[model samples]
Target: MSKPTLTDLNAFKAVAEQRSFRRAADLMGVSRSSLSHTVRTLERRLGTRLLHRTTRSVSLTESGERLLQRLGPLLGELDTLLEEASSHEGKLTGRLRINGSEAAIRLLLQRVVPQFLALHDAVELDLVAEGRLVDIVEQGFDAGVRLREAVPKDMIAIPIGGDLRFLAVASPGYLKGKPILETPGQLALHRCIRQRLPSGKLYRWEFQKHDQEVLADVPGAMTLDSSQLMVEAAADGLGIAYVPESYAHAYLREGKLVTVLEDWCPHIPGLHLYYPNNRHVPPSLRAFIDLLRE
Candidate 1:
């Protein structure tokens, strides 16, 4: 019998699991054509067809089904062993890709990432800031940040920051002419700034008071996709902006902005560092999590 390559197995596994070459390629961070070629190469080596592919659908053949059933647990075990081995190694090295919102990255990159990189110079950090949620595994990211421990149970979640609150702030000029909004509904009467998600959808402003929880889809004079830009616009008295209170503090104190509707914006759980529960967490991610914990 001829020996098989690890790449062959990995490619085959991805194709079988996702049932589509395009999706498999997405998960592996390779082009669809490259993934298709890799799978064909594996098929040639085996001298048998493993997947039945049509224009619209792909399915595993009988042989492919048997192979997947056996390889799934084996691959899982290997991943665990790899993480365990790296944990006990003298020097750890690998690239760690983290997906998160722009605001959270800004809050952590300066103080947290530099410290981790200094200790683990062998590791490389890839931080991607996006507004919409994505399938991290399919996007070739090692981990993602969620607003709290609200991520999927299949992922291991570590709370990176403590409680956080959204601050509604505006320039003194803007507020001078507007009536103070006693309720979220009154926000409709005031000009507001809005942000868009990566999915090209606007983020709905969430508010709570007593037993009345309101999600306002308020119209805005200007629509933006960045928190920094939103804050800057609000500082110029364009409208009120909902921003993380932590980032709003400096501007509020420096007279660049004034916070309002403090009682409406209550503190909640902060950002969470999360990754697949059974994934082979590279050394860089493990170290970064530890640093975040400290």
Candidate 2:
């Protein structure tokens, strides 16, 4: 059998890692049929079946698993070497996949992404913004952005933003004639725009004052998942919203909203960019981390 082309090997690896032809093809910027054909050709050259495929699922055969175990490291080293060699010319070229929530991605887009892209025009950034936290390493991402508390303990984490606060805010119209909320416990008697977490659970509003902590399961008729939406809901006089202070800044300035429990809204650790400690850092990812720090 003739030796397989590097393109074929890379295509096979993509499929193996994604475990879905549709997803792998999308990642590689190729059509599903084309990616499937390349992997089949690779298997044919090696005289072995590499994957067990059904309509809804794909799994690697034993031979395929062994091949992937050996090939993953070699290809990673090749990519690192290629990126390093390219960097000698004062340019960087590679793809970086980062998984993050909407808030974290927005922060990067505003602060880090523009500079990183300008400095390394050839680097492609695949930023996946979602509500759920994922295993970045298992999902084949180069890094992940999350709040420091949510970052996995085993990964190398770098702070990307300053401390943040979650404030209880309501429109002046909603607060008119209502009893002033002097403490978090008073939220039980007031309407609140409830927050739904990524895990499908209602978020309990947490507060801290003088080293004492309080968790309130706020009552309300409305349940929203996004902070921006909650802020809007509060502005519309639907209910009070507990959200990141940044989301309510404009409303506060315009007098559309006011914050209650000001002293109880304590600063918390902020966003972090984290990556697997054991893996080699790609040049583009390293540059991104550096830019974020700056």
Candidate 3:
């Protein structure tokens, strides 16, 4: 029997891991038909059925499972060794997959990405902007950026940005007839624009004044999933929006929105870049982290 080529092995791995020809094709940057053909050719060469394919799903056969169990770790180690060797040569060249929230992506694009890419042109960055927190390791990401409080305890985390504050803001038109919102409690009396988290739960507005902290489940007439849309809604006289200060900055500067409870909006630990502690840190990711710190 002829030996299976690296392309065939990689195609098999991608399909087996993803369990979907469509998804594997998307990740591999190849057509679904081509990926399927490659896997079939691999199976024929090995003289065994490696996968159980159905219209709706794909599962590995016993042979495929055994092969994956053996090959996965070996391939991972090989990739790591190659990355380390390249790093020693002072040439960082590899894909760095990052999962980040919208706000984190904004900060990375504005501060780190451009400079990092310029310094290491061969490195490919795949930035996935997700609204919800994801398990980076399980999702096949090299690292993730999230609010400091949201990072998992088992991961190694490094703060990538300064402290961030959340502000309660509304348009002048919406505030005209409303009573002054001097305290967080006053939010209940006004029409609020609430934010819905990725888990489909409403995010309680949080505030702090000196030693006192207030978490208000303020009632609202409108709820949105995005901070940018919330700012736009607040600017359009919808209701008060509790958003990160950066998201509302332009509106505040343009006089489209006014802030309340400034004293309570204390700065908190900001975005952090994190990865699993047990994994070998890729040189590309390490370079990016160092750039962020600088």
Candidate 4:
């Protein structure tokens, strides 16, 4: 019997771990049919059925499970060793996948991304802007960007931006006839725009003054999942919107939106870049982190 090549082993491993040919193909950047063919060739060489595939799912055979148990750690170590060697060469070259929030993406696009790419032409950064928090490892991301408070305790986190605050604002037209909001409690009487969180729950408007904090369940005629949309809705006289100050900056400057209950808005910890605490830091990731710090 001919020996299975590394490519064949890798294809099998990806399929076994992902348990779905389509998902494995996406991660390997290959066509689903090609990946399936490679796995079949591998199975023939081994003279055993490695996977049981049906219309909806795939499962590994007993022999396949044993092979996975033996090969998974070895492959992980090999990848790490290769990454370490690449780091010693002093040239960063590889893909760096980052899952980030929309606010974080805005910060990167402002200057960080362009500068980093210009400096390291060999590195490719794949950034996905996600509104909802996700498990970076399960999602196959090297790192993720989120507010400091949102980062998991098991992850190593580094601040990437300064403190941020939310602003409650509305278009002049919307507020013209409504009573002015004097406190967070008075927001109940106003038509507010609310944001829907990734968990499918409405975000409660948070406020603070001195040592007192209040979470207001402000009612709204409109609810949106995007901060940009909230700002736009407020600017179009739909309702009052509580959004990140940066998102509403342009509209506020243009006199499209006016602030209300400014004293109640609380400053919060800013965005942070977080990654698994127990993994070997890839050279590409390390280089990007250094660049971000600089």
Whose TM-score is greatest here?
2
Please write out the lDDT profile of model 2 over residues 30-88, one tens digit for every residue. Answer: 99999999999999999999999999988999999999888888888898899999989
lDDT tens string, model 3, 1-294?
Answer: 999998999899989888899999999899999999999999999999999999999999999999998887677677778888887888898789999998898889999999999999988899989898887875578899999899999999999777899999999999998899899998889999998999999999888989999989998978999999999999999999999998999999999999988888999999999998987887888899899889
Please, what is the whole-model Cα lDDT of each candidate in the order they appear? 0.81, 0.92, 0.90, 0.88
Q: Compared with the true structure, what per-residue lDDT tens digits does model 4 show for residues 47-151? A: 999999999999999999999888876766676677677767877776788999988978887858888898888787888897888888755578999999999
Off by over 4 Å in 2: none
Candidate 1, position 133, lDDT: 81
Better of 1 and 3 by TM-score: 3
Compute the lDDT of residue 114 as modeled in candidate 1.
Answer: 81
How many clashes (backbone atoms < 3 Å, residues ≥3 apart in a chain or on different chains) does model 1 have? 0
State the lDDT of candidate 1 residue by residue for 1-294, as single tens digits. 465688888898988878889888876789989888888888888888999999999999998998888887676566656655665787666567788887768767866988887887767678888777877775557789878745777888888777898888988989996888777788889998998877888878888766677788977889987778888899888999998887678789989899777778877888888898875666667778888888
Alpha-carbon TM-score of each model against the true structure: 0.75, 0.92, 0.90, 0.88
Pitting candidate 1 against candidate 2, the one with the higher lDDT is 2
lDDT of 4 at 266: 82
Q: Weakest 10 consecutive residues, lDDT, candidate 4? A: 72-81
Candidate structures ordered by TM-score, highest first: 2, 3, 4, 1
Q: Clash number for model 4?
A: 0
